[model samples]
Target: MSKTIESIFKPHLKPKEVYQGGKNPPTSNGKKIYKLSSNENPLGQSPKATEALLKAAKHIDVYPDQTDIRLREALVKDFDGQLNANQFICGNSGSEIIDMLLRAFVNEGDEVIYSNPCFLPYAVFSRWYGAKQVDVPLLNTTYDLDLEGILNAVTDKTKIIFLTSPNNPTGTYIPKSVLDDFFTRIPKDIVIVFDEVYRHFADAEDYISGLPYVTEGHNVVAVNSFSKTYGLAGQRIGYCYTTQTIANYVRQIHKPFLLPITSIEAAIGALNDTDFIAETVKTVQVGRKYLTAEFDKLGIKYWPTQGNFFIIDPPLPEFEFTDMLMEQGIMVRPVSQFGAPGKVRITIGTQEANEALVKALKK
Candidate 1:
């Protein structure tokens, strides 16, 4: 006789798939766990950021800058007037900013276009709002963005196009020339959500982040995170820069005082620590090359990467490969959940961790 919970829910709401984060490496029998799953900065956070957080702890009772104005101004200064404070909106993480983009623009039955095996939040959140996901499959051989396929898939119903540099799992990106071609062909009215959270580690000669498009006043919203580059994943700070029009819409939904005081201060500190950032990028570059060379020596097939992580097309099934890696006290990401079977993504970690990963794969 009890009233059912489903009866009161909105008719459009369906059971959405939960996002799977990287697992914690288990410590069993005194084995050291090397976590290479989440693509986190294995080097850890900046000392300057740590100092800033500790200093800010004295003012725990105080609220954060309601406008997040300080971080916005820093970003403006960081980018050197290519953008202004009014064009940015800081969020808890890049994921939240992506979600906000959907909230501000996508309506029911709208179509969101993105490559398959991409950052899952785009699909997950689009469905949360009853939007249809139009996934363009990756080219089988290269595992890169199928720009031709993407163009063929677009329709008038499309509201947003999600693009990532050094894309998730595969770590493949659309080359600048390809992006330019696509932009010229695609409708300018459709919003492009360009996620470049891993930009700092990407050293490819032809790579270009979305900021240039934003400066040209294209309908592009570029999202970057302090998580990976600044090693502030724990702090959960990120920002999105876009046209003034898009920023105004996001501001309507993104309330003030959303970010905390400690996180804000740490992010500011992380931004100013240019020496730490340069060193981190250099280390990641070295590690990336080391892992790639090791993979080649092992005769393992991997996608060339611009990001700190690379994808391996392992001989064994992905789940089995992951289990084997776990037994060796190293954790790597399996891409079955990301829609690629028999493939795994490995984060390029410290020299020691990278060496250990290759050793485990050899067995």
Candidate 2:
């Protein structure tokens, strides 16, 4: 509207892209869509967390704890039996954690190296901050990390490198030995961010989470979410553990009263409820196994998954296969967006939802 407003803008946002969220199913009175697109917990939010939210409803007039002291303390009790509170800064979502980290470290024109066909929002966010986003290909059909390619992608401008274990869409993870090797060659100054929202699903002994690296004094930010494991995505809660120095830097850039009061209470309740955590993991484990067996029986080619979602290279074009599924009121993500052009990423939902997809495929 004004020249001052126009002059303040940059070309990076000339055409801002919409973040592609998970599909919301239809209504006639809202028919439930078997939502397998986003790697959401098919089990729904934890009952204890829900109970806490309902109990906390009367406190809406009060502001949320700005520092999330209670939630941070809870995180310390859980993740910190090994690490500590000083290692973490809690946020509204895993995405918000990224925003805080970027604000804390990235300067204008710095280089950020992330895997191509990796997390889509990251590319958008990096460019928005005026940092260049470099995308490298997955080494094979599965989106496993290529340590050499990643090291080669790094440059003098590189500030951060993002690695997702049990990576989304394709569902492959880097083994500990490989990640150790990858970290060895990177410049000591460059920070590495590990997004492990789906780490709980991994059963492989070698499929390590990033906590070990953090313990060794590496410049790493390891953030796992309560949303996926505790089914609290609606509450938008996630936390990151970094070096105490990085945590201090991140705290300054974080928005005040960020995590809602009720959300924090819910997350605390979720943290305490170990029975629910065990049950959710078991249910997903059962569902994931059933889905894999069904895919194999159907003779459908699918990537071996260690996360909540897996990619299947369908017999048709990616969009065409997706359209067929959507018409049946089942929504799955097209893997083309993540660089697997002919595949679809299917979240392992309930036994029924997974079976429904298999039935749809049979047609």
Candidate achieving the largest TM-score: 1
- Over 1-363, each residue of candidate 1 has an lDDT whose tens digit, in order, gives 788988888655666576888887675778887899998987899999999999999998988788888999989988987888999999999998998899998999999998878888888888878788899978888877888888888899999999888788788887899889988888877999999988888877889999888888889999999988789998988999999988987799988899899999999999999888988898889998898888889999898998888889887888888899899878988887787777898888989998888889888
Residue pairs in candidate 2 whose N, alpha carbon or C atoms collide under 3 angstroms: 27-30, 92-236
TM-score of each: 0.96, 0.95
The per-residue C-alpha lDDT of model 1 at residue 234 equals 87
Per-residue lDDT for 137-166 in model 2, tens only?
A: 778755678788888888989998888888
Candidate 1, superposed: residue stretches over 4 Å from native = 1-3
Candidate 2 residue-wise lDDT at 247: 79
Q: What is the lDDT of residue 24 in candidate 2?
A: 69
